[model samples]
Structures are given as C-alpha cells and as structure tokens.
Target: MNATSGAPVNAPAELHDRPIGDLIRDARNLSAAEVEKVLSYQREHGVRFGEAAITLGLASPDDVLNALAQQFHYPLANAERRLASPELVTLLQPFSVQAEAIRAVRSQVTMRLGQGEAARQALAVISPASGDGKTYFAANLAVSLAQLGGRTLIIDADLRGPRQHEVFKVSNSAGLSTLLSGRAENQLIQTVEGVSGLFVLPCGPIPPNPLELIERPAFALLIRELSTKFDHVVIDTAAASLGADACVVAARCGAALVLTRKNENKISALQDLVASLAGSSAQLLGAVVNEF
Candidate 1:
C-alpha cells in the first residue's frame, strides 16, 4: 500500500472473510481428519474452533493468533519469523497499553499535521541525549502511523549511531547515509515485510562526516522530496548534545517531537534543547517522557 495515496494495501486475497476453521486449518497445516477432530471437540466442549484446537494442542497460541490477525486485517509478525525486539509493542502487541499509548501519540500528532502544505510530509523525532528511547519511540510511531492505512516512512537519520534498520529488521547495506553520500542509486528505501504501508530509509553505513553530510543542501532537497512521496515521514536523529544534527533535521522537517527518558536525561539538558527548538524554525509539536 502507498501511504502517500489512497491506494488500497497490496493485501493478500481476502482470507479473513473465511471461517475460522478454514483459517486455522490453513494456518496450522491441519489435515482433513484433524479438522474433523477439532470440529468434534469444538461441538463437544461448546468452544470456538480456535479454543478447541488450542485445548487439543492441534494449534499453538501463535498459530491461532496468526489466523486471527488475518481475519482482522491486523498486521502481525509471525512469531517464528520476527527478529525485531519484543519492545516493538506497536507491532507485537498492538492492543497492549503501550501500543495504545503510541496510538494516542499518533492521534495527537496527526491532528496537528493536517495540512495542505508540503511541510506535512515529515515529523522529526528528537531528544537531548541518546538512550532516551528515541529510536524505540520513532520505530513504534512509524509502525503505528502505517497502521492508519496509507504509507508511512521512517528515515533513520541517526548517522552517528543508526539502529532503525535493526528495529525494522531491514538490511542497512545501502541507505540514507549512502544515498546522501552519492553512492546509493537503488534500494535506497525498503518496504518493510509483513507491515503494509511502512517503509524505511536506514542510516546505511556510518559515514565519516555525519553532520557535514546532513548539512549539505542535498539533505534539505531529500526532505522535500520524501515529504512529497510519503503520506507520513518520521525522521530519527542523533541526540541534540551530539551536535546540531537534531536541530538541523527538525528545521528541515518544520516540526519535531522531543523525547526524554526518566533517570537518564538531565532536566537541564532537556530544557536547553526545548529552548533551542523554541527559537528554531521548526514547531515543537510536544514532548514525551518514556519510562523504562
């Protein structure tokens, strides 16, 4: 699905409309004889087919969940296939409290981003320091935004210590840094597997002059181009203290969300960063405090 347009997702055939029994059978590779047993047990116990399958150990919980996800059009990763962190609450447990909170943040951000202007393309996720859950929050926010249906692109601009490639389980052999450095010509952005309408521009290989690259006029051109191509853009940046990278990124995007973590971030640093943003061209959308 192109999040930039109203196009429908490139979803698989409508399997969710099928009966749970059929979904369960296909999901678990159950034979006709095994399906009969599940049906028999379901009737005998007055339980759903999925429940009966689970009770009989014919299908694991993950199997049931996989079938259910198909039935609901919910984007879910197969437990056997996911390589990202469990803390990716938005994708792993979309209904969990954490995911819900991310959705809430998305709502707030979306409400603010409604516009007919080009600045609507990207939202910079920034912080005063590292290890403040900026990448975590940025990754989840991108996923949550993608869940809204259209395409959402999260650009890993953290050239100093990039990690969105790992968070989204994508190859970082050629990405943002490489593209900015004039080396990448193809596969600059990869469509995330399993998550529809989500794309990633990984930080690519670490560059020698990260700030110099971001400061180049090409960076501004890139932001403008990306804004036009994607429905929503989320750019993750190095901490403000690392340099003016975050500030520059936020300025280019025209909006930013500042993040802080409990016990790790110095209040004075956050105050300084916020103050700095207040004086910049970018609008300070809001601040989020991440605990644990």
Candidate 2:
C-alpha cells in the first residue's frame, strides 16, 4: 500500500512493499466486507490479521507467509509449487536457518565485491570435486542476490554436469554451451518464472569436450558480454578435480568463491585449491563450508 520512497507523482510502488495485512488485502483482492470481518475476527480472537484471514478461509497459509515476507522486505516462493528442486531454500523457505545463512554469505560477498575501484563483473562458484554442493549453493546464492532488487543472472557454466537449469526449472536444450559454440538456440537466457530479478543461462547440451569448450576464448567473451547485461552474474562451474574449467572460468570472471562440503572435503585438498585460485588473477572472495 506504500508508495515508492522518492517516486514521482502518479507513480505506483513496486509489488514488493511492507505490512502483512495491507499486502494480503492487495494480493488476495479482499473486499471491504472481508477486511472488516478479518479485523473483527483478529480482535476477538486476539490473533494477527493474517491468522484471522487464514482461520476464516479468506486466505491460505501460503498467502499469509507471502504477506509476512513482504512486510520484512524478503522474497518467498511457495515451497510446494516453486520448482522441482526444493534445495533452493532462499526461495522455498526464505526464513529458514539455511536461507538465513546463505543470505549472510550474500551480504559478505556483496560488500567485498563492491569495495574495489573496478567492481568485479561476475563471481564463479567452484569446488574441488563433485557432490560438494557447489550447484546448490550457486543456485541459492543467486536467488538471495536477486532478492536484493538487482538483476542477477546465474550461468550454468558447468557443462560437464550441469544442474542449474534443472534447479531453476528452465529448459536446457540450448544455453551457454550452445551460445559459446556458435550454435543457434531459440532461447539462451531464461527468466525464472517466479523469482523476480533473477535469470538463468542453462548449460544446454552436455558437450563431450567441456574443458576444450570452456578453454576457448568464446567462453570468456560470453562472460564479459553477459556482465554488461546483468547487475550481478553468478557462474556455476565444473569441479576443479574434473579439470581446469573452474579455475579458468573464475579467472575470466575476476572473482571466485570456493565451496566445500563438510566432512567430505579434505583440508589439504581445499588448501591446495585455494592456492590454485590464488595463483590466478581472480580475487578469492573467501571460502564457504557447505554444511547443508
């Protein structure tokens, strides 16, 4: 119900705004009579307006959660209906502990990323091996960054074992690999259906020579080109143990975040991975231990 903070006359606020009751009223299109009933029930039952609305079957539990999320200026997509991958906790459970932890990581990454004279164009999420939760972290982190109201894009650069397209529920028939290989696809970049300010460039078909494709200058050129079109570009890369794809991708992006699974990732391997990334020009934006 609130207008944009310094917006001009006749300008409306973004759908994203404050207050649970007002947001619910607007979102559910409640009538005046419905609002009065909800308020009276809320007062009589000593419950919140959203609770009253849900109790009266005027609004669903998902509606109440969405209103609450709007009040706190956070983003939430229905867990039951968002996508096939429930691992994107930032969208599916924005208030959960896992989501909060990922947001904390986002905050740190953003702050560190903006400190330099020349801000980095993109960030590559890399891990030493598969099953290290690299794809999961990249997908969730992209959602969190998009929640900051910036146009954020997550590129599925892991041509070997790409999962971002599946995670975001976008078609991977033609994406980064196809685009880099000079092949034509109907749609290369896709706007994620539910989450605002988020986009995905899937890995397309799995190339037999993923390393060779990534090693080509076209891949770096594509990252640079995409950087100009997006506010924040998050790249999901292949595992370092698989090849040098992650390192090369990170070097091209100018920044990298190292991810490791708890108990499964060896300390020595992680240290060596850090050293390898450090040797490159890419700024090491610190490492994340993926416990989830």
Candidate 3:
C-alpha cells in the first residue's frame, strides 16, 4: 500500500494544522531512519515530507522553516548573498583611499569617546556643494568600517534627494519614514547582502519637510537606537550650504566629514561651511579634497 493508504486516513488531516514538530512527533509508524532521511532531504532542498504534507493540504513547510530560522538566529540566504554588481564593485574599488581617511576620523572619535561613555557615535558626510563625491565617500567609509570587522550602518539621510538605495541598486519602498511611523522594523531595515556586517537604511519616500522630519524626536530616537546597534553609523547628509537638512544633521552628528572639490567656488563654499560650523558643537573630524 502507498504511504498515505496505510495511515489512519484522518490522522494526517488532524496533524495538518499542527506545528511541524508536533506533526513530526505524531506521525507514527514511520521508522526513525526513514524520518531522519526525510528531515535530511528537507534540510538540503527544503522539500520532501514537508512539501508532501503541504501538497496534501496538511501543513506549510515555508512557515515552519521561517519560524525555526527566526527563533535560532539562523542566517537565511537572501538577495544580499548575491555578489555585488560588477559595475558597482568596480566603482567602489577606488574607495580604498577612503578606508585610510575613515581610520583617521575613527581615531579622533575614539579619543573623544573616553571611558564610561556609550560608543554610539554618528558621522555625517557633507560637501561644499552637490557633485563633490560626498555620497561616494560615505558609501566607501561604510564599506571600510565593515572591512574592519565592525557592524556598520549607513543611512541616506539626504531627505531632499536621497540616492543611497539607488547607488546600491536596492529598493527604497520603505525605510526611516516607515520606522518613524511605527511600522515593523524589519520592513524598513535591510542588510546589505554579500558585504558582511554592513547594513543600509535607505531614505524611503522623501517627505515634503525633510528638515522638520530630521529634527523630530522620533528622528533622534531612531539615530540613538541605530547607533547602539551598529559599531559605526554613517549618515550621508545633503551639501552643507545647500539645504537646512544638512545643518540639522550636522548639529546632531558626532562628527562631519567635509568634502570639497579642488576648485575656487567649491573651496569658497567650504570656507563658508567651516565658519558656519566653527562655533557649533559638531566636530570637524577632517576634510576630503576630491579631485575631479
């Protein structure tokens, strides 16, 4: 007789709605060796008796595996496991220079952090004006932090015109705004696959008042929470002189990585930004002069 023809016909039906473990325990008459083989097959290909159960309208294999993975902190393979896009990886390779820059900045912050203080530090990347490699610097800095064995989180806080998700070719359907609105945390946060220890919180849908949103208590709380979770929190703020959002972020950030192109107009803007932040509490960690 077939496997199903021999069982108490309604037995599988009763266990159908039960948990996978319960179903496994109650489905008697199946030998221990046979049960182990079924389990092994399931683990290797995510199929076998579980799928048969579901196919026969008994239980859901997907849900069971998901629950078990979540309960055990099992690292499930996801889109992030795919290798970084060739073009994007090539573009970021030059950022090896930024790795050194970040080390220097990290030293300064470490000295300032002293003992007994929380290691929650924030860093912002700002430029004299647009198109000065600020985002590139920020992205590279994040990668650098991950390379150093730190859990790094990069936030595209440029609400006015966010680009982090686009640069990484990821979805921006949900992010900081969704989190601020009290949505599920997993929905807004995504781990950058392939790059171990690097996470990104894309600037979801841009709101009308980017400055107002950044200044909200929710924003501060989010930053604090994220800082605690990651070893490094790098925020890509808008150009310092071009938007109010940048200034607000600058005021809250522990340090600012100023970017200035090697040019007269940009240098002038950088000078102005330096003067503007000179008296402010935000530490001017250092500046990066981007060539072309």
Candidate with top TM-score is: 1
RMSD score of candidate 2 (Å): 4.5
Residue pairs in clash, model 1: 3-150, 3-151
Question: Model 1: which ten-residue window has the lowest total lDDT?
Answer: 1-10
Q: Per lDDT, what order, best first?
A: 1, 2, 3
For all predicted structures, in order, the TM-scores are 0.88, 0.86, 0.63
Candidate 3 residue spans exceeding 4 A from truth: 1-119, 181-186
- Cα shift from native, residue 94, model 2 (Å): 1.0
> Each prediction's Cα lDDT score?
0.86, 0.85, 0.65
Per-prediction backbone clash count: 2, 0, 1
Off by over 4 Å in 2: 1-34, 43-48, 54-61, 70-73, 115-117
Question: What is the C-alpha lDDT profile of model 3 across 4-47, one tens digit per residue?
Answer: 12566555443234555544434333466655665666677776
lDDT of 2 at 174: 91
